[model samples]
Target: MKKLLTLSAIAASFVAPAMAAEEVNVYSYRQPFLVEPMFNEFTKETGIKVNVKFAKKGLAEKLQQEGEYSPADVVLTTDISRLAELTDKDVVQAVDSEVINANVPAQYRDKENEWFALTLRTRNVYSSRDRVGKLGNDFDYIDLANAEYKGKICTRSGKHPYNVSLVSSMIAHHGEAETKEWLEGVKANLARKPQGNDRAQVKAISEGLCDLSLGNSYYLGKMVNDKEQKAWADAVYINFPNQNTTGTHVNVSGMAMAKYSPNKDNALKLMEFLTGDKAQQMYAEVNYEYPVKEGVKRSELVASWGDFKADKISLDEIAEYHGAAIKLLDEVKFDL
Candidate 1:
């Protein structure tokens, strides 16, 4: 009886740590369909289970409130602006993984290693291929303000985060004065009041209410694959604007290690795994995004759209300038 008791105690001790170490908690702004399969695959490959909580907003605040008691080991979110907010709030920590360093480009990863982008989404112009023809060739976003496109261009409200970042990129590239003028000019060219997401703008283009619009490249991918969206995507010719000058404005869906992650090692491992070829490819192929991992092929659909130079501006700068971009939008009466 004594020997059995001692053996039982030893077994419990070993099992407890094993059970604790086998799980990682994640707070994600990305939809479950976008992230779950990868998590399921990770568990299958490594035996480390993932516990995820999905929300569209307030994740950073939730993480901040949880603080040291937070069970989250990792955070995954879209857009550089939100990631920058997390970094500013110190909700995430810098990770030094050699795999991450090698795979993610410097422009896509935080300089201090707080976060790294796994996939890229380029914001570019889309136009009616048949309507513009040669005029669409070698076109750039800066050309949106040209008199010819006035009352012919359609886009989301500048209040939208995506457009804000694009405007911010212009500010970063052209300085405040020039950027303000550019915003006012683009505002002058609106086909109608800015009031929808990227897809809606594409719909407007397809309906002949407009001839061109700005949208993320992945939207085109989603459109082509989705039965309902195929017509709108098919109706437009994709153009990667600003290619010769500053490259296409790109953003990311990225990941970071939580500041008080209890499963630090596992979290880092997961981050590295995401940056690996398999996960990167899965992310891009599934979502119609460009992989940040070097040499990972984009989805055939994305590749079919052809390639363009991506803006080299550090996305962190885009984040930093977000507020000013919003102010510029207001000042130029972009919303009205």
Candidate 2:
């Protein structure tokens, strides 16, 4: 009878594993396709399910409204500025995990450990293969504003978060006065008043509307996999800017632990797992993002773009200048 009771207790533990079996709630800016698979993998590994709330915008405000009673255990999104935004709002708590510290680099994580970068993507210049050709690879980001490239460039709205973050990095690297001049110059060089998404700019290049475009590297992967956009993807070659000076400008997709996590331990486990080998590999393969953790190979499609050294500037340093970046974009009337 003692033996039977012990077996029954063991089965009960399996069925009811305390908080470990409880679901972790995540409020994510990342789209479902990019994050759902990772959650599925995590559940399979630990039996701790992940439930996500997807939003294109306003999740930050929602978390703030919920306050300490927030069901959110995590915030998942791209860009260091968004990560910094969470820290500024006081909605995220510090994560003192040694596993995360070991897996994430000092440059890609918050100084206070409130957030950690999972992946990286470069802000590259894509030039038309038939028009700009091999010689375009020799240009720098600073060259985009030069008169030699006048009326030959296309770009998304400067107010867009992606461009705003890039401008922030420019401020970090070059300082206010020089960056201000550069922004005005880029605005002057626009062929169409900064009127589309990054992929739209690439499409413009392919359609002969522009010879060059400012865009992210992963879009090339997305476009290559897309039937209608494959022609646009095939029409260009990637250029890593600032290679002669600070290296290429890059940004991250990162996550933070919510301040009021109801499942702190399980959340920490999921966070650590994301920085580990398996999840890092999925980030590289599934998302076409460069893994923050060392030794993970990029997807074959990404690898074919050729390797380039990433800019070594601390992302937090760039994020510090985000407000100034937006202000300068307005000063130049960039989108207009």
Candidate 3:
């Protein structure tokens, strides 16, 4: 009976860990198709089930309202502005994982360790290959505001989060007064009313409606890979601006640990695991983005575009000045 009791205890101990690995809930802005494969792979490897709630808007407000009662263990979003908004609202907790710290570069992660970038995308300018005759070798955001480019440039609405962040970064570097002036200059240069997403702006360039427009680096990759999009992608030359100065203006799709997470340990494990080699590679290849992990190779599409400098500014700063940037954009009447 003694030996049987001992054996039973050993069996129970082994079973406990399996039972402990329950499910983790995630709130993500990324579409389900974009992330489900990764989630499936994670479950197969770790035996942890994932439940995700996805929406294009208002996930932040939902998390904020739920407060401590929120069942969400992790929050994922694209772009620095939204991630920073979550940090400001205190919806996320500061995490200090050595794996995350080592994998994500300083510029890409929150200064306080509240969030970490999983992948990077550059905000670049695309110009018709034939019209530009080899787009300027080095251009920065400031260059777009140059008087020469006025009435020749095109972009999406300034209210767009991506453009707002770009304007915000300009404020960080040039101060509000100068940034506002730059906004006016960019506005004056608009070929037509700012309309459409980044991809649409590239389409405009391809159609000869505009000479140049602002776009995200990865969108070009997506275009290049698709038969219909290939012509637009092939028609333009992508210019990584600010390489000689602040490097390229880059943004990220990142993740954070929810403050009210019931499964904190598992959440941290998932965070660290996502920042690891396997997950980083998956993110980069699937999205055509630059990996946050140092030394990870960019997608062949990204690599073919050539290397450039990336801004070393902390992304949180860009988020912090977002309101001011928006105000400046409004003052300049950046209709696009």
- Root-mean-square deviation per candidate: 2.3, 3.8, 4.1
Top candidate, metric lDDT: 2
Q: What is the C-alpha lDDT profile of model 2 across 56-151, one tens digit per residue?
A: 887778889999899999899878888998999899999999999999999999999999999999999998999888543356778889987788
lDDT of 3 by residue, 99-162 (tens): 8898888878889999989888888988888888456556678878788776778788888888
Instruction: Give the whole-model CA lDDT for all candidates, comma-separated.
Output: 0.88, 0.90, 0.86
What are the per-residue Cα lDDT tens digits for candidate 1 across 103-151? 9999999989999998899998888866774344367778899898889
Model 2 misplaced stretches (Cα beyond 4 Å): 1-21, 135-138
Q: Would you give me the overall lDDT of model 2? A: 0.90
Residue 71 error, candidate 3, Å: 1.2
**What ranges in model 1 sit over 4 Å off?**
1-21, 134-137
For model 3, give the 10-residue run with minimal summed lDDT. Answer: 131-140
Model 2 TM: 0.93
